[model samples]
Target: MNAPAYAHPQATHTVPLGGARVAYLLVRSRRRSIGLEVGASGLTIRAPLRVSVAQIESALQEKAQWVLDKLAASALRVQQTPQVDWGQGAQLPYLGGLLTLQLHPAAPRGCELLAVGEGRWVLHVPLPVDALPASVRGQVHAWWLRHARLLLTQRLQRFAPDLGVQWRSLRLTNARTRWGSAKHDGGIMLNWRLLHFRLPVLDYVVVHELSHLRVMDHSPRFWAVVASVCPDYTRLRAELRQQPIPEWDL
Candidate 1:
């Protein structure tokens, strides 16, 4: 269940985001909230353990104007993202590379990369022109994620055995704020959109999460571990922060 939200126990802090007076509806729980995060996508009202719904809404109302404005801005950004046809000649970003669509009426209603160009790749799909964008995007995202995951696995497998660490499973994540995370049981969560970044950025993220196997927090020791494994990680680390994921409909 989504945890009930309440007034942040201590006090409320306010900040301005995008010329709007953004406020925090701090809802405290035994589990530190995922936290109030406003981004270009929208708002994610994270629920904390043992919080009250009334409090969350109360806070929501208190900042309704800010919420609406930010959400509207998010909507505009999404609107501004031009859409493409499901047919041939669609342009999409893939792993810091460009993918052009080449719709060929073949296969049992699935998709695949038809071929590669000198600096671009082609995604082939046999879907109707009016096909649902959500379904089309989901398929493309899944295909690329599978490919990226395979490559990521290949890279990490070489490093993991040396550290006596192994990942239980690998899956695509759609989280807005986090690029990757590691579980105590050796599970790893990675944003599928990481495929949009350059190789160094992707490597840094993979190493960052893998380093969590030894240390869980963003402490000095964790950085040391990350650096020890992936030297020149500092530059890539900064790059990941500055590089924004390209948003696609889904």
Candidate 2:
């Protein structure tokens, strides 16, 4: 595992495990046991308020191998991931292909679908050529949110009748860890970032969430429900996990 280049200001301690140095954010909470999470942001350690620093170090030492392995894996994933370039002429994934961004200062202040080509698209944004990346990113993000709502609604309406389930409401979400979620009250919340994926992947998520209306838990029966509607759900699910969405802050 590569050593953490920088640590969060809240990081309390640094520990050496083999050849790698792990700098983890130490969060003192009311929990009973220490928890270690290795994510895109690297290591985070959570412990009870009364736990001593030595105790925390000891606990981390005990799980040193596991922590290093997870960190290494996360580092590899980040290395392979693609980051979005918020500038003119930058390309981003849209419906399994790419969308080329074009800045049109004379046009409106928002983004407009200009044209579509073979396996690609042109998004005309009404921003000056020298617009700040932050401004461009914000406008593009807003546009994607609007389209995600419309397209997801259409997909739900198209598939819900076939599955014999009626969704009460649809809400767009920006959760970092979840793609979509369902409530027992027929409310469904899907991640707007899902616009990064293709239509079939989107449909799989929709069907998977609607299937919860019939079977709430992820048992074999629940999968059976999803498979009935999306027979290639297994493949689509893998693709959803393996494919990298462009990283962005907005």
Candidate 3:
């Protein structure tokens, strides 16, 4: 009899552990210990410069259950994530509600927001219904980017005064791993994908980054500052992590 064989589609390194195939990227760095991170891209293993393959595999075998659990969760997340369609009646998350996409050929070449009903809004794209999906997606993406900057800026301004912090500049980022980050120099970069979340979740991130201006680390003092303004931040932060953003090819 032959043993079962497993394949890794996008893995740089493959190993067999606990009757399963584990695919990971092995990175040799100056670190002292083996660090593992599993994300949408799969597992990544960072090991010390002098670690041998046998040592690395031994470490992975020890953490096989944790690695498999993370991989399973990542797969589940990918499977449950909604994909965006660039056409009429397409719905997406916006400010704690649904934003539907509508096409109006005679409108114009740009996109506009229309209030359709309570807690509902329609994005009126100037393209015809027959427009290419890529074209429609590009136009809608541009609109989202423009509005993201404006909305994020407004929130930052609103919270900075309350937090007693001064922001030097803001950059809209497309980062996959981090929602927001702040530099010691008062520059903040926020992921535009945050538009997928509700306003409270968005505000939490805003207040979080601004608080870093006073305390650059995530120590007790920094969290105290965040709680000073957003007392329910703990809940909001968890919700932000649980809410899945729609996947877009564009």
Candidate 4:
């Protein structure tokens, strides 16, 4: 049976799947989901403690299609960018360019963020470890996403003139299922991580959502509209198919 939605997380547990240990992670959220999450090393699953191993396995098998799709997407994303260490002075892709981190010395009081020059962004810190790992990473990610949204907005603004479409608003989120979405009121939502991809990939996603303003579904006509805007949509789609959704957690 499906677990209760919005319930408190139960304790973590594990089960055997073909002799490999499959972790059953309990996640408390709007809905309970029992699925396999692929990571750099391998897979970690989330399921209610009461769910039997048999049921978990069945669910995992049923979700194979979804797992495969996300896995492919994640792989492509990782391959597109070179390997990076998750620490200080790490280089990350931002808006079609590489940004290197610089840990500064003492500041006035706390850390202040600013784009110092063409490639450098200074984090004015009182101490090296003041904004350790997560804090530092979070701030940088926020900057990247903010810059990405601005760039996307500029690009989408150009499309409105051609198609007579008005984009009401835009939001960035870590959505797993789709790259972008269009709302009835002409609003759009995109995965902020798209900033990590190449410009062509981002353009494809932007065009895909803009096309939705004219035709809301993936019918033949809607695809034609998308094709008109992104002639190489097929190649981009294939590249997208190759990557998996990198699961930060189960």
Predicted structure with the largest TM-score when compared to the true one: 3
How many clashes show up per model?
4, 0, 0, 13
For residues 52-110, could you state the per-residue lDDT of candidate 4 as single tens digits? 66776787766655655554545456566455443456666544455555555554444
Instruction: Please write out the lDDT profile of model 1 over residues 5-72, one tens digit for every residue.
Output: 22222335444444444444454555544445455434556667776756565666667666766566
lDDT of 2: 0.83
**lDDT by residue for model 2 over 10-53, one digit each (tens)?**
56678887567777789887777788866666788888999998
Q: For this target, which candidate reaches the highest lDDT against the unseen true structure?
A: 3
| Superior candidate under TM-score, 3 versus 4 | 3
Task: Tell me the tens digit of each residue's lDDT in model 3 across 1-250.
Answer: 4533333345678898777777777888777688887766677888899999899999999998888877777778878999988787788898888899988787656688888787789898988888888988898999999999999999999999999999999999986656899998999999998988889999999999999999876678999999999999999988976787798785
TM-score of each: 0.67, 0.74, 0.79, 0.59
C-alpha RMSD in Å of predicted model 1 compared with the true structure: 7.6
In order of lDDT, best first, we have 3, 2, 1, 4
lDDT of each: 0.66, 0.83, 0.85, 0.62
Off by over 4 Å in 1: 1-20, 25-87, 107-109, 128-135, 162-164
lDDT (0-100) at residue 58 of candidate 2?
92
Give the true-structure RMSD of model 2: 5.5
> Candidate 2, clashing residue pairs?
none
Which of candidates 2 and 3 reaches a greater lDDT? 3
